[model samples]
Target: MNQIVLTTLNARYIHAAFGLRYIFANLAELQAQTVVREFTIHETALNIAEKILAEQPKIVGISVYIWNVSEVTELVGVLKQISPELVIVLGGPEVSHPPDLPAVCELADYVVTGAGEKSFYDLCTQLLQRQTPLNRMIEGVSVPLPQLASPYQYYDAEDIQNRICYVEASRGCPFKCEFCLSALDKTAKPFELGAFLDEMDNLYQKGARNFKFIDRTFNLKVKTSVAILEFFLARMDDELYLHFEVIPDNLPDDLKEVLKRFPDNRLQFEIGVQTFDPEIQELISRRQDNQKTIENLRWLREHTGAHLHTDLIFGLPGDTLENFAESFDQLVALNPQEIQLGILKRLRGAPINRHTDEYQLRYNPVPPYNILSTRDISFSDMQRVNRFARYWDMIGNSGRFKITLPTILGDRPFERFLTLSDALFNASGSTWKIALKRLFELVYEVMVGTLLVDSEQSQTVLREDFLRSELKGRLAFEETKPLTKQKVGKGIANKRQKMHQ
Candidate 1:
């Protein structure tokens, strides 16, 4: 029986829990007695409890996050009722701070906060030896970069083959963007590069084709960034795919040169252009060179083969719907592969809370804690933006409406799209589960009837998009054409990849 179990509810099965593996790897002498169990939110609390109980764990450590916190809270409550003697421990960003803990924290027997690897292991050691700590909250000890063991070796054959192989060459972010939990970090610190690469090589040799780096500022150190890229270049196969989150403004010549060498769709950069307004940037202590960011985005699109996935957050303290729309329009013009439209959430202990009063920020008070309303944007407008984001995912970002999107968006991208988003929701009474064929019809109807576009133009363009989408069925505007098969595997890793598959 496993004496110590490290577990977490992943958002999806495809995501192997990277943090749980790190803690498991560092369990020291307790490694033999410990096991790592992962579950997803989709599973019922009773089912998760049954599997967890089967292990007969003495101390159960659960890694909580914003995505799975509510379900985890319910799971923890279930565990407490069934196994009162079980020592429940909670550790993760969700439970880490706010001296004011949530219901989950109160239910947990012990809580370890911040850089929890070493601290958790030590707690297990103490508990297993029949000596429990006096206080429930334990301050996590930060191990030096060189001293911390590489977590890559923990990935098994199944994980490497099926899930996103998450690897981090470093920890922390230098920027103090108030909305992000990473703003609490003092500075960015790199692992010993040689050691880190050695572990990556080990992973690569074992058939890990997909490597998604968890570094906050990957391109910050040009030398380090180039070395990692060069390592992948040495083992360049058509299957080798890498994902990095790079600082939008900091693409040096050395990094770009290496980046350009990679084949198209082989590299994906998640660029965070949270806001284009300088006032919001300053208000949030975000230091983005907006001019440089635009230049780099345009350059990446023009020069490199990298798939650019950019982000824009709607509800910052001072941001208005009009300015947010302007930002959306600006980025739409650049034409990234995907635009992750986000609503700002109040993360516990995040410095963004400083503006809660001034901005009249009201959050959902639930798991994600997404802003319900802000001083600048009304609740009804926020709901409209929410619908806009949802329908945009189905239509705009799906890349299925390439031919018709430009016409629908026209000169004012945000306003025009907002109009369409409103009409789609009003017509369909949903932003979800609309079949591809049905979506095409909805867009066509909205274009011709609501937006008052030319019937012939709408039908022609919508039918072209429909044909390109390669659906099986025919629409009213369609003439029959054979559909082309979609290809997906081994290279690109986005949430949208499933549709093509």
Candidate 2:
């Protein structure tokens, strides 16, 4: 029986918890007595507690996050009630900030805040050795990159075969964007390149193909980025997919040349252009050269085969509806593979809280704590934009209506789409539960019946776009050739399928 069990309720089973694995790998002498167990938020807290108790673990560590805090809170309560002697340790982002500790911490025997790899190992050693552990809450010391043990070697067979294995070549962020939790970090730090690559080589040899890097700035160091890219380039195949969150404005010529070498759909870049407004950027201490960022984005779209997923945040302090629309239209014009329109969230320890009074920012006071209203944007306007974001995801980002999307969103893409968003909300009273065929019909009705576009032309364009993505469906417009004969690229088809699922 395992005397120590490291467990956490992950948002999903497919997401392998990297934090727990870090602690497990660094357990040193206590490694043999320890085990890691992962469960999803869907499981009942009682059931999760029961499963952990079944292992008869004397010391249990639970990694907590905003998404799983409620369930984890209940699970911790149940564990305390059933097994009074069980030493419960809580770690991760949810418990890292002091002023915003959730109610779950009171039930926990110990809470390890911040980077818990080394601290967690030390705590486990003390508890497992029948020694009294110090303090109820311990602040984790940030272990140096080269000094800490790598967590990749502990990824089990099932993780390598099925899950999206997360590999971080670095930790921390250098830029302090007030809205982000990473803003608290002093500076970005990279792991030793040779050692990190060796770990990656081992994972690749073990049949792990899908790798998602958790580095905040993957392309910061140009030469290091090139080496990592070259490593994957030599082993490039159909199944090899790598994802990175890169600094949009920092893509130099060397990095751009290396990035262009990756095949279509093999590399995905999540560039965070949170806002295009210069005034707001200054207020948030987000130093982004808009021109350079836009230029890099254009080059990435035009020159590289990489799928671009760009982000935009609404409801910033000084952001007006008019300014946000300009940003939206600009992003649409860039023609990224996907645009993630996110509402500003007031994170627990984020410095963005400082702007709350000045901006009249009101949040839901719940998990995710999305901005309900700001000084410039009213509650009703925020609701409309929320619907606009969802509808855009359905029509624009789905890649279903390629040719017809521009037709639907006329000269002023944002204003036109906002009008359509209003029409959609007024008609359905809800944004979700809209099926593919129904959505097609809605678009046809809006464009033809309301917007007064030529009915015949609209129908033909919509039908073509519909046929491009869907395999089986009869359009309201016309009869088309069966998709069975169409030769769509394997990568594009797979992406669409995954998105819909």
Candidate 3:
């Protein structure tokens, strides 16, 4: 019975459509006629189209992102084929910029770029009223922070119980990190504190526990950050977990004091230590104090109970394998819970595009266009690092190998791991669909046979890691058969590393 349908293919089901809710909240009189539906990329386009057409929407709006762009393009094609008159509106970061707009954006009946909460409503109203604009693209005008409606009220009971709800106290980032879309924003903008907190309390009372703040820099404003932390702390329980992306060097004593108040593992800080090289930092107009970043990371590790998930980019204008390895080793030495190794991507409108020719950069020319090669790093070498990142995630970040990781990383962490990565790929031949039990057996074999670690010590720690994993099985390497039977080069080719696509 609804005339307007808002939909998107979410990367995962647990991620509720935060943007769709914002647009839904501001729909005004059209609110009653509208419905929001979310699907995952795992679904086929025809299957998703069937569900959307079931709504009989007069105008359909699809939220697009880099991860889902490829699937969504297929969705748009199918929708047009089946329902030619069905108005299709596209919006979100993937469709916001032109010149590099993907095929799906071009196929959309209308595109709303930038902040779409208000703009989407305006476009839908015009469409339904038969006052459609001649121009296909609509520029999304920014609404004042106070005037912007809170999207939290749209979360139903199911969302509150099962999903990771996204909330933002502010919009935009003041720092001009050239690789990010937020760099295009003039400055950070905060919503009215009292009103925002009221909405948060409402969400908490309604059984929402997992909150992920989408603000680009949650720690940018010390007073605001402290207030939010204290608010959550006052209502803290074992079930309440919060996540925030904080600037690496900006933790003051005030922030630290509040951070210390939070109990263990309740808070996670995604610190952006993209690269430790000053030259690369300056190249991308990323201003970070490496010394303070190191100091703060060490302090957080020692003084606080928060889990640290640090980031490092593998490919950049000035990055070479040697320097990136140095950055990787630096992060390993700090001992964060997770070291996210991200490959540099050419976001459509990001200022990093200016460095293309000088760096000899080659992008994949696909969705989530990651850098394939640079002047200093060849394509083959980049692929090696790509595989290494996947292996590292399974071994280092998964917390499965907590007992044996230090032994694997050793003194020259990156060098040794890269060597192991090469050997792993050589043994397995591909890097996907690796069974957990099989991976343990492979790692045990590699450590004992390929890397030539002391067999007794490697088996001891690896056995501890296996026990900790709680994965019940007799490891192929640990079978009752004689040592000669479990060969390292045997059909363990079943699994390797797949760089998270």
Candidate 4:
């Protein structure tokens, strides 16, 4: 039997890791023995290497991403040293959308671009048939094959309940946000809704309670997006939860009505605003109506029970620290369920790379490749923003902030935590875990000192433990919840203050 091995880091363990089920399921018909293995680079790379070596597969395929690329590269180097003759194929979002990706050309023998379902199968067949190198085997983009199956599958319902199942109803993004790779690859080809619904049903039956749509812009197509929503609406019985990425300004009245039918906690939408500064938006080629976005957000809050997660990007071209702060304050005023503060990622295929000189942008040399600062923003300000990103991830989105921090502070003022944590971590030179612990401690102290709540630390600790247990893999979701009765009381008080003020 022909044997093929596919391995990578698990998506559930890391929030940034996207699912590879579609690739595995589509290539299932290649008439070969296949094994899929998952492990964290931080967990055990060498042990995973040993296990895969023991299998002695003919071909080894590994999915690469920004977070795990270094680990995967190192693992591949070790794997090749041991086996010497294994055919290594690399593919995924990271490799697919690079202008001149070094890892693909030097590390992996073959790099499959775009959708790998058909390309992977074709390459496997050719290799088995005595083709030495599959260099000319770039599928999907180069050759238009109708038979190319989309690789996506829902996991066992019971297994999926504990994990986040990522599904994609479409491919490609329709925007030209210069800083984003998806913007360059705009098209937004949607799949059949009935077929997608059937796939979802299979997953639902298997025990999935949480689903995240990986589509670039789910709301770009009203009819298709609405159909999927309606299908889920018909089946939603409080047991299932779905998450989507939506364009805030493009939200339709009809979809808002559909969302209203579902329980507030059952559905969530992550809207990427990037920036509210019109000049900054124009610089990045991101077309957005600042006023419309705010109005649409208010409409969703009033009409739908769905949880709202809004995003803001720091360090865009022509944006200073003051501009970013102002944009952040405005977004916070909207009172989203979650505020994801992201720094700019200078991706390879992104159009913004072409305008580096025009913008006079200098980015970091690390994994994230964030902008250092430009004429509009200073280097010191960018460093401060870096700290802001770290704290926001931990306290704002991590779900632990609401539990300890007094909600007496308005959304805009609560953001002071980001600046505070930035200053503290810079002084201590501490790791994120250590920084997070300190931030939580300080937040508690502030709450108690300010009389935000009465003595209820003991009750809050138990509640936190419960949340940690209930949502083991979903740290972001778990940490964002109000942990104590005191905190909950403070939240109510703060809401009343907002209304009255």
Candidate 5:
């Protein structure tokens, strides 16, 4: 039986909790007595409690985050009720801040704030030795790169085989973007490149093909970026996929040369262009050269085969709905593979709270404290934008509506999409539970019928887009047939022939 169990409810099963593994790996002499257990937030709190209790762990340490905080709170309460003697420990971004929410901390025996590896190890050592730990709140110290044990060695057979193994060569962010918790970090720290690469090489040899780097500023150093790219480039295969969150406008010529070498479907870059509005950027202390960012995006789309996933946040202190629309239209023009349209969230300890009174920023007082309304954007506007984000994901970002997307968006992509968004929401009264067929129908009806697009051309375009999707379900229109292999091939050929013409 494990004496210490490191557990957390991930948003999904595919996401292996890197933080928990770090704590597990650093247990040192206590490694044999420890185990790591992960569950999805979908699992009921009672169920998670039952499973943890079954292990009969002397201490249960949970890695908390904004996404799983609500479920974890419930699970913690249940665990305390079932085994009052159980030593409950909490760590991670959610609990690692000032003004600890009483709802979560009251039940916990201890809370470790910030870099948890050494702190967790010490706490476990003291508990196992029957020595009363001095404090309930432990401020974690950053362990030196060489001194800290690599979490990668703890990856099991199943993890390497199936899960998207997260590896980080660095931690922290240099930019002080007010909306983000990373702003509090003094500076970015890199692990020794040689040692970090050796760990990556080992992981690769063990059949871990999907590597998602969690570094905030992955492309900050060109040499380090190139080395990491070359390491994976030499070992490229059909199954190989590497994801990194890059500095949008910081693409040096050296970085560009290496980036172009990566094959299609192998590299995916997540660029956070939170806003293009200079006023909003200034307000949030977000330093972004909009021209450079746009140029980089266009070059990546034209020259490189990297799947670009760009981000845009809806609400910020100085942002108005009009300016946000302008930013949206700008992003849409770049035509990235995916546009992650997110509403601003007030994370714990984020300096965004400083603008609460000034901007009249109100947020939901719960996990994922999403901005309800700001001085510039009203509650109604927020709801409208929320619907727009959802619809944009379904129609625009899904990459399903290739030919018809421009037609649907017209000249003003944001305005057009917002119109459709409002229409769809008004008709259905719900953003979710929309089937593919119904969504297609809604788009056709709203864009073609109500908006008065050329009916014949719109129908043809919609039919081609629908067939291109290769959806298993029935089509929105009666004339469309099920996509057979032969039909799909013919449709693709016809589209290719038209493109050549």
Candidate 6:
């Protein structure tokens, strides 16, 4: 049986299977029989090989990521060994670069960079027709296409509704944020706006309401961004919501007026205010007019009902932990819906590679490759910030920010959690499952004691978080058991430890 298998190492439990869904839907449109399976990062080489062999696929495509490349590579090796005739293809951000992508090219027969919707379909058609492989037909910086498909290939609504649904009105970013992986290419070409609106209509019809535009900066093109916002605003209903990553300083007054007309929760903006320090910003090729960013942010808060999600990064060139904390304090005073704290992830292709020595940044030599701040922010301080990031994710992103305990936790719980998380991390000895389980257990206990007045909702959300966290652990099948309230907590903790260890 001729078959196509597309898979990815998932980001988390709840994320809709995007790449596979896209490819499968495209094939369905072409009236082709196909199967798409997804696995987590923990799914081993043997595990993947067994699944592929079982499927007896004619074609196998694996979506690669920085975190999952090693495992994916091993999987590739095993699959090739078992059946060298299997047509193996790789794609995604991890391979969206020059032809000399040693890591990707070494593992697979073909590397598909950039938007794979049209290219992937063409490949399938050729393979079926007994034509030569159309690897060169794929398009982007590395390979230019004479024709590219309309940004069709519907993102699965069922898969995207619960987690953030990422839609791209455009590709590429105009910014030069050195640390930003998205900013690698500066050509920001948008899809035809009307065509984009049509896609949005289809998605909306499919029951997708929460959308996060994958545009590097949604507001870079004032008129285009405004048009899209107006279109959504015209269609606004209680269930419709949109999130954007915008440059705070560039926000227009007219846009402010438009935003003010919506409910506070109708729109959300994740502003990357990586640092307030001018030196640091310039050093990292991030040129935000700080004064303008501040003014624009203030105006956004005062004039608009849009919920704000701001971000700050630790361990940038000159940013000490103390300096980052100061920035954090300032952001807290602004009271965004959430303050996403991220450490600098040294992605292979980011411009930050050029400045490793200049910044004196020492990083972990493994997956995620986060930096340990230099003299500006000591190793201890980096640890503190890491703990801070965990606490923020638990209380802030988990939607527990409204509780009184979050404030209490914000006041002093971070320090204690940091200590405990560190100790647990050490004891668990790189077993992320155990460390996260212990972290979640402690965080939940603290929240329950201090802020979990609404136990019913908190418990529901916490359990969901636990399920997502489970995706991070080493994979082992346990038959689904009926969970009792009394045993749920213990069961979750035990499962997490099992996955990690």
TM-score of each predicted structure versus truth: 0.96, 0.95, 0.95, 0.82, 0.95, 0.74
The predicted structure with the larger TM-score, 2 or 6, is 2
| Higher-TM-score candidate of 1 and 2 | 1
Name the runs in model 4 displaced over 4 angstroms: 11-19, 97-99, 134-154, 157-159, 398-419, 426-431, 435-441, 444-501
| Maximum-lDDT candidate | 1
Query: Given candidate 2, what's the lDDT at residue 179?
Result: 93
What C-alpha lDDT, on a 0 to 100 scale, does residue 90 get in candidate 4? 85
Deviation of model 5 at 70, angstroms = 0.4
| Candidate 4: residue 469 Cα off by (Å) | 14
Model 5 lDDT on a 0 to 1 scale = 0.86
C-alpha lDDT values of all predictions: 0.88, 0.86, 0.87, 0.67, 0.86, 0.67
Tens digit of per-residue lDDT, candidate 4, span 394-446: 55555554543335234545356554555556555653556444444544544
How many Å off is the CA of 160 in candidate 3? Answer: 0.8
Please give the TM-score that candidate 3 achieves against the real structure: 0.95
Model 4 / residue 400 / CA error / Å = 4.2
Query: What would the per-residue lDDT of candidate 3 be over residues 192-302, giving only the tens digit for each residue?
Result: 889999999999999998899999999999999999999999998768888899999998999999988887777878999999999999989998999999999999998
> Any idea how many clashes model 1 has?
0
For model 5, residues 148-241, the per-residue Cα lDDT tens digits are 8889988888999878899998988999999999899888899999999999999999999889999999999889999999998898877788
Winner on TM-score (3 vs 4): 3
Clashes of 6: 0
Top candidate by TM-score: 1
Lowest summed-lDDT stretch of 10 residues in model 3? Answer: 492-501
- Candidate 6 lDDT, tens digit per residue, 313-417? 888888865566567766665666667888887776788777888768898876667887664778887876786587556545544323433433455444443
